[model samples]
Target: MGLACAVAWLAALTVYDVRQRRLPNALTLPGAVIVLITAALAGRGAAALLGAVALGALYLVMHLTAPSAMGAGDVKLAIGVGALTGAFGVDAWVLATVAAPLLTAAWGIVGFRARGGGATGRIAVPHGPSMCVATVAAVAVVVI
Candidate 1:
């Protein structure tokens, strides 16, 4: 039930992100809180919180250093995404965190090329979808 909810939450966020290019705090924050609590009940609170902090911090740094490339919403979304993967263990968390940017970069490169390579000075690819995908993928890998 919790897993299904998380999947639906991520799916909704993914759709919103692709359409609007923003991950609203209302959704992201609540999801994080729910997942964190769930993780705690599941006896993985500390590690889950650490995962949230770790991935959230990483995205925060990216947002701070390159605001154009990373958004504040993505930073917020990372917390929940991290916790989801973190519930499995460090391996899932690390894999999700590492894969997110790579997936986003791939999207950026492919999108840039598809757009004729220089129509805009920068590609505005949203990172939330990639983050969500990475979390799902990592958890799937770890679990199966």
Candidate 2:
């Protein structure tokens, strides 16, 4: 049940971020609450809490130091990702965190290449899809 909800939330977030290039507080805030509540109900509250706090802190620092790279919405969405993956275990949470930026970087490179290698401007790539994919991949590994 928790996993399903998490997946659904991720799907919605991915679509929204891809379309708008922004993660709205309206969705992310409520999604965080749902993930946390579901985690607690599933008897993984400790792990979930730890993951949320750890990832939230990590993203917060990134946002503070590199505002242009990380957005507040991404920070908020991290809490939900942490809660979902953390419910599985610390390994899942850690893996998701590590994979997200790598995935984003890889995607950005692919996109850059696809657009021809002559452009030198900064491209705005949505990080939410990377986050969602990493979270789902981590969860799948832990669950199966």
Candidate 3:
């Protein structure tokens, strides 16, 4: 049930991000809260919640330091991701992190090819969708 909810949440986030190129805190905040509470109740403990917050902060720092590479929206979305993956433990977080960038790179390469290499740098991608795919793939790989 938790996994299902996480999947749906990621899907909704992806749609919103793709449409608006922003991940509103309105979505991520509530999602972070809910997932954290759920994980705590399910025996994952408060550590997961703290981990999520830390992850958000880490992303925030990256966004501030390299705004061209990271965005506020991605930082916000990381809150929910941190909660969900942290509940499962470090392996999930590692998988998601590794997968997200690799998948993003792959998508970027494909887009570059499709565009005849005209996009010089930092093409705006609907990264929420890429994250969603990466998160799901990570979960699948870890679980199966």
Candidate 4:
């Protein structure tokens, strides 16, 4: 059930981010709640849910320090990833951190080239979708 939710969330994020370049808080915020509730029922609430929320909050603080680099939506979405992957331990975090941006960067390159454009500051690819892909990939690596 958890994996299914994660997959669906990733798919939604990908479509939303690609088309809108924004990850709605409406989606991410409720997701964090669901994960938290599930983690609590699983007896891993503190570590999985609270910990993830802390991580998300920390990311927000970091973003505040460097708004030019990260966006608020990414910070909120990080909480969702943390909630989902937190159950698996630090490895989940590590995998997600590494994979999401890498995938996003790679995709951005191809996406831009396909549109007959080059990378520039004006073109900002949403990080949420990349994070979503990375989250799924991370889960797959951890599970199998």
Q: How high is the CA lDDT of each candidate model? A: 0.90, 0.89, 0.80, 0.79
Encode model 1's per-residue lDDT on 15-129: one tens digit a residue. 9999998999989999999999999999999988989998889889989999987889999999999888888899999999899889989998998888788657457788899
Q: Which prediction has more favorable TM-score, 3 or 4? A: 3
Candidate 2 lDDT over 1-144, as tens digits, reads: 656777888999999999999999998989988888887887988888888888999999999999999999999999889888888998899899999999999988888888775667447688989999999999899889
lDDT for residue 141 in candidate 2, whole number 0-100: 91
Residue 19's lDDT within candidate 2 is 94
lDDT of 4 by residue, 1-144 (tens): 877976897788779877987778888888878877887888878778755876698778878998866788889888988877776667876788777778878877787787778446235667887888878887788888
Q: Candidate 3, residues 1-144: lDDT per residue as tens digits?
A: 888988998889989988888888888888888988899899985667866887788888988998978788888888888777777777877788677877778888887777778647446566677777777777777687
Please tell me which predicted candidate would have the highest lDDT against the true structure.
Answer: 1
TM-score for each prediction?
A: 0.94, 0.95, 0.88, 0.83
Q: Which stretches of candidate 3 lie over 4 Å from their true place?
A: 119-122
Candidate RMSDs in Å, in order, are: 1.3, 1.1, 1.9, 2.5
List runs of model 4 lying over 4 Å from the truth: 111-122
What TM-score would candidate 4 get against the native? 0.83
Judged by lDDT against the true structure, how good is candidate 1? 0.90
Q: What would the TM-score be for candidate 3 when compared with the true structure?
A: 0.88
Task: Please say which candidate is ahead in lDDT: 3 or 4.
Answer: 3
